[model samples]
Target: MSGNEKISELDKVLTQFNVFGRYHCLFMFWSFLALASNAVFCSNFVFSAEEVSYRCKDEGFGNDTCTNMANSTAECSEWTYEDPNSFVAEFGLACQDWKRTLVGTMHSFGYMVGLLLVGPMSDRLGRKLSIVITGMLGGVFGVARSFTSNYWLFIALEFLEGAIGDSCSPMFILTIEIVSSRNRLLFYILCSFGYPFGGVLVSLSAWKFTYWRTFLRVIYMPALLFFAYLFLIDESPRWLLIKGKKDKAIKIIEKAAEKNKIKIDKTLLEKMECEKEKSVNFFRLLKMTFESKIILKRFLICLVWWTTSTFVAYGLSINSVSLRGNKYVNYALTSLMDVPANFIILLSQNYFKRKAPLITSFLVGAFLCLAHPFLPANLSWLSLIMYMASKLMSSFYFTITYMFTSELFPTYTRNSMHALCSSLGRIGSIIAPQTPLLMHYWSGLPSLVFGSVSLIAGLITFLVPDTADNSLPDTVKQAEEIGKKGDLKKPAPDFVIDKDKDCSRL
Candidate 1:
């Protein structure tokens, strides 16, 4: 059938059962998995601060008991301080900051590459394929980090792990694409809360392991489980239609309708033989994402939001020296706060419109980040409080961004835009680790910078149209047309409307 007939059929089915009500559960389940997939990395923090030591003997020293001398200082007393990467250290390279940064940079670079491919690939091959490929690869690479003794191999595998694991971007696109418009924002926000919760899990696990390599190995096991579960999933109907696979789209829709106990029109099948399939080119995809006026506007706003959110969230986590009476205490406290952050967005979201919460949350984060630096160093508790508040606020905005972007573009462009935007967000994360190094040169500079970035992000939010009141866009042309009209709150274009009354569109 034609696109119009398909939409009409889908709408008819939607009317029988509240599209939002029946499908929200499915989307929520997928979102939970997405959270688990992304959080595995964050939860490794418990092992981040554990101390390790080595022993050695004195050669020509004054002490007669040369064998009693330790090779390295456990405290901050040594000049060299254990250069794990030095030729003498052998297996110690994993402990060095430069090595970690290099590994991290490589990981970020992989996301940069994955972003370009995964998004378009999702649009072309389907969200299910993209998720399975990336999630499975991530699982394989994530597990490999545990077995390697070679430093170079570990870095390479970790980089591959990052690239593959970051597939959550496409997964989010897929999850939101299948859900109704009404619950989209809430689902996005709630699903996003997984990042911090993942951090909590990492912290708990790493604390148990107390060694970075072992911690890395143990934390990412969930991805394998998630990969196994993907076979049970159905492709996005909207994506199916975009790819001209109307029959497959209808089959899934009918199955969903039957599963939900709703009926669909039998005649809809008669109208299925519709349009010629158009092959999408890479330049067109790139133009759709980067060059179009509509996409450029979305890209800029998303970039600002992603960069500021990442920098603020990570900066506070890294620089908040006052969060704990000690490091472990700080890890526990920060991890626990994620639970509230997750639920707060879940609760406050139904009561408020999307725009206000996002703007307010980000601004609040900026305030907390700024305040953290000025509080007296002696009053460390106050600093910790500020950091926690900042974290809560950052989490709120971060959740909103995902939902917002998922809805902003049409299925033809959603995965592409989401991936590129998320990739840019990783760029911000890569920039985040270096903030501490910058702060070492001038104390308080990092917070001030992060705070300023947050403020800017909050302000730029007004530039885009609010999605709190509309259905997701279903076509690139519709998105462009809507952008041209300069009305974000206008009723959705004809393309997104559902036509069939029975749940049989499956």
Candidate 2:
């Protein structure tokens, strides 16, 4: 058989097992739990580290309740927070604005480190093991974070939580690898929903528990549950196949077929041949990503879009605390926007493909964000509406970017590229918490920056190729070829397998 024919046969064999079976559903359940846990942990600080009404301690102050201290010139000798159990109250981070931002910054920095470490680890070790280890470690650290009394120890635990908790990428990659090509996009959309769902949980927890430590304990509880369930899931068959564990891969496929109630001839498994395993170190993956101009172009475009999406999405989310209203309602509404965002993507992905929706989302989100500063001071309601709209649109942009970037790369390098882009994207998140600080410079400066970057990213979205309905490429060379084809004007049809012919051959 020709090389192309061999690749086609492999794709056919892989998709033969029902992708939407009970097994796949079980996998997605575990994946969503992990994803949502990470999301809650990531956003929990928005509430936990919130600044509360504080006043300086002085002899003249009435029971640590100094009124009109906002205009006071006296240095705060000691601070008393409204919520005595809040991080600020416990750590005395009041008046030290940098420390407040550092709480989030450290988490993001750890997330970047996790991405860098976990990506290569996923490639070297199986995806399931990597997630299990990281998930358990993240859970441990998350629980530990609640027990820390020392400020620096809390910061270190937060860093560890970010490092271990942010293993969403590997779990995501595993979901993609396990499902059939036609069903991949649907699963991706479903998985992306977990993030906002997590955000909603965070808001609800904050509303229920006024104490930060208690809230931390609540959000981290899911991780422990997820860790127990991790043992029930199987390793990705594709990963096993690639690693030359043919017998193990065949058994997984057989089990999936059995669970899905499909009867297949055992002889068909004998036809499968493992490809020569390449040494896929980080440097080799990096070299492969940039060696082709088309791939390089796509990577650069995606990097910008991912970075901008994360920046705007996280910025708007974290900045909700500063909005003029009940912070709980503002946060819950912002997080709930993901529901419509996911619906819009699912509804529009077929008609708009990848680039159109992304561009439109970015443009709309940018307009709303940019218009925030110009709204009348008396029209706070309108300002809130604009902020919610911006959040919705940014959420839409963020969700689709994950799908788009996944489709742009070949299977072998997909996780590596995703990790790299996500790590780079963390720069935006790291900067997002500090954006509220920018309000000190100008009331609208942060919004202006977010809107401007999103606008530029929208323009760059035009350069990205559409991979709608296309089969995933198995090699880097094939990926380059797909990129060279540019925007797919016509949707590719799904791969169909000839069961009778395969059975006869077997």
Candidate 3:
């Protein structure tokens, strides 16, 4: 932590602006705004695409819900929906659970492709363009979706918006690049509240609007306004400096300082511009990984960990709305659980070794979920308690694993490896929507699968190396030697491309 080389030159200059920082707060607010909109955008299925209760007219069974019509041999051509305002109600998807859940699966498919294109585009084009373009298009598509009654068109829009419009990852990178190193964790923790806040906002909006089309248009209204971000915020000066746009980067810095009512010297900026990052070739990294025993073992293990984490985290989120209670309250509670999990991760960063907390959280959470189906029918409250507690545990390990994956890899290939694991991890989300369909097979089947995956993920943490207190490894040698008793060199750049974040977008 004492190494001067570990701090980037841009970070040093930005430290002056971090005090009495109006500019910092202003831009960070914009980032969270994107996050908020992104939350409601990704979670539309919780209300709109969920199965609604309905009764169909049949000669043998009169006014019985489709779920209650399980054993009846009668086919009902006409039906009455209890909600009158969900996708199921309009599309006649009452008896078809998989069709009801297909919207969520399609959305996840688009999100996976978006994550692939956005990161490199943010590097090549500017953050402002990425954020603004994606935001505007996402809104356009979302608003367009409101006018559609065809299920095929609705799902197509879902895919289009996801692939082209997700802006949160770019916004997240912009925030990290602009803020000083010391405040990164605090800034991230504060801004992270946006997702949960957005979830509550969605719940309230849906409750008030009561119609899927009305709710869809209402949330996307704010996204159309993101075009202002093009002029309102500065391009990340750090990125500009790295990309050799010194004059533009300097102008941004001077503008930031001027807005903060401070002065900066021109010579200082020029001096810092000379620092260069090592060029990374991803193809070479593949060769290096195969040559190192520990590195290869670590990468393979990360595949499992990342996949299981996404499966459990997102599966629980989807299940929250399906729980036997007020659906809004269930989702709000599950979303809010992430707030404490974020803070706990920040607090524990200095106090404990990372492995124990992660392992314990996954293991204990799995046990809670495993016990969810055994309680008596009268003890609904206890069952709810177990479900919520399990979600809390999932939040803990889910947040922690982002950092843990970064710590496990060598610097030159870290971003590439993280991206690979995350993309594959999308498989978990791809399958999560179908979990509700599992209930038709057995009531307890979904919970059993969630707990079983969590248990396997928890047990596998013992196989990979622990990275607490060790300097970040910049080479295969250092990565292989992680967790050994020694002071390793911090050879990588101070700034890392942070890939550990909400799987909702990236």
Candidate 4:
């Protein structure tokens, strides 16, 4: 067989192994850890910069103006914080609440900027190196931030950590790289379960360790485990082949085949090794995006959808810091919503078309958010239920955007476009921390903003083409013709994944 022909048979060769072989299990375990770490790294700000009740040193807590300075610190010569070890109290940041909000904004900014740099790094360097290196850096800087006495140093570490903390995406790419067409969704869901659990871990850790430093130590010290991944995890064979390192790719796959106790077709593998190298660069990604009108239009729409999803999703959890009930419980509940959301989304991918679920999640969430503040004090419990429900919807909306965005563009540009959309979407998370500031203007202002943007996004979602069980587009013309003519090209058997895999077993 020719190299091109052997390439199509690669899937056939891989399917000969058990679905949950030793090599696959090892990769999944590491990817799960990386994902959970990403979650904690991003959401730790809620506790690290948590609100602490404070009063002027001279003014007693009984004073009318000194009750709770969560929103406004009101100039003071000295202060008494309920938790001296809290983020604001530790730094003597008594008169400024903006500094507290800045923690999340700066970290998100770092993540946004880092997203652009890391995607290219993953492509040029390889997937496993990107995950291992970034994962290790996030752990090191995170631990350093916990020990720092300087506020500026803490803030700088926040940005540095966020910038390099984007290992989840690379981990995701690597997870799918090893799986065959039939089992990709199984791996995808398996890895994503780690994110929700990460939030629960952070909240539980913060609840146990009230002090900021202790809480951080409890959260980040374990991240040191990623350093071990360098020796433990294998490099991606597919990435190696594309980069013309066929011998290295072959060696990894041979090991995997052996661990799975499956014999390999040396003849077929030899032909694959002969395939020509295909290189991808950021310049090509940029050139292709700008060169196509349909993709450009969809890209703009995707920005709105992605921005709204991140804004509302992150806003709900960030705002949970100030909820009426148990802080840890509220935060955990909000974060935990992702569990059901993922399950529902997984079901949607199999049973429903993409557009309807995307639209309903946003619209229903908007309605719940819009109605939240209007409830009477007597019905506060009902409001809390609605809040959790809204989070569930936002979680579903956020995950589905990723799947839909990949289908909107051609095969060549799909990953790059998705990464671009995700990077730019961090803008929502960047601004989400300031909702506490919005609350000062009107307690309901944040909800109003979240609801309004989500409403607009749902309406805009109608314009997006539905990609139910359709084949992914392969060319610019085929991409533009979606929702009009049928698929211009069928998907290669290599990626014709079985979408109806049983979710119950997972």
For model 3, the local distance difference test gives 0.72
Q: Summarize candidate 1's per-residue lDDT along 1-506 as a digit string, tens digits.
A: 43434444444443344443355455555666666667665324224422233332233222322222353333221222243423224445323545544554566567666777777787777788777787777877877776777878876776677766656876787666565455455445555656656666665675577556566667666677666546667887767766778789788878877766667776864453323335668568666556567768878789888777766666566554334466656765665566687677666655665677788887888887787779898987677677788777876787777777766776556777777787778776666655656654767778788788889998888777666555455556545544344433424321232344222211
Ranked by TM-score from best down, the candidates are 2, 4, 3, 1
Error (Å) of candidate 3 at residue 12 is 3.1
Ranking of all candidate structures by their lDDT, best first: 2, 4, 3, 1
Q: Report the Cα lDDT for residue 369, model 1.
A: 76
Error at 232, model 1, angstroms: 1.9
Compute each candidate's TM-score over C-alphas: 0.80, 0.90, 0.83, 0.87
lDDT of all predictions: 0.63, 0.77, 0.72, 0.76
Please, what are the lDDT tens digits per residue for candidate 2 over residues 1-506? 43334445455565665535566666666777778877887888898888677766655455445443454555657776777777888888766778978989899889987888888788778788888878877778888888889989999999988886666878888887776665666667766667877888889898998788888887786676556645687887667766788788778888887886777666667665534347766688678778888888888888898789878999999998788878888898888899888878877875676778999999988898898999999998888889899999998898888878887776667787888888888888888888998887898898899999999999888876767765566567667666455422224333333333221100
Winner by lDDT between candidate 4 and candidate 2: 2
Clashing pairs in 3: none
Model 3 quality (TM-score):
0.83
Model 2 stretches astray by more than 4 angstroms: 1-7, 13-20, 59-74, 265-274, 485-506
How displaced is residue 364 in candidate 4, in Å?
1.6
Per-residue CA lDDT of model 4 for 397-452, tens digit only, reads 88778667766865444455666787898899999998888876788889888999
Which candidate number maximizes lDDT?
2
The TM-score, computed over Cα atoms with residue i paired to residue i, of candidate 1 is 0.80
Higher-scoring candidate on lDDT, 1 or 3: 3
